[model samples]
Target: MTSRAAQEEGVQFGLADTGNSIPVGLVTGIAAAALAAGAALVWWMRRRRTTRG
Candidate 1:
């Protein structure tokens, strides 16, 4: 019984790890795009405010 439980636990742990495996390149690209978009938005807002004021 103990051996069976250990085997099942190991299988579950492996599946969990694999489920979280994401491509690093994809993650980095998304982060870079979001950061660039945020910066552009801030710059636009500040420029608009300055022009109005």
Candidate 2:
């Protein structure tokens, strides 16, 4: 009975790990893209303002 319980727990952990990996990867990807875009926008605005002034 203990072995059966251990097997069940292992399966649950494996499933959780598999399910979480993709969304974690996707969130990181989105965050990186957003940061890059924000930096680019700031740089462009600064350049434009400098030229105008």
lDDT tens per residue, model 2, 1-53: 47679788774333434455467878889999999999999999999999999
Query: Against the true structure, what is each candidate's TM-score?
Result: 0.66, 0.57
Model 1 C-alpha lDDT per residue in residues 1-53, reported as the tens digit of each score: 47679788774433434535788889899999999999999999999999999
Please report the TM-score between candidate 2 and the true structure: 0.57
Best by TM-score: 1
**Residue 33, candidate 2: C-alpha displacement in angstroms:** 0.6
What is the Cα-based lDDT of residue 43 in candidate 2? 100
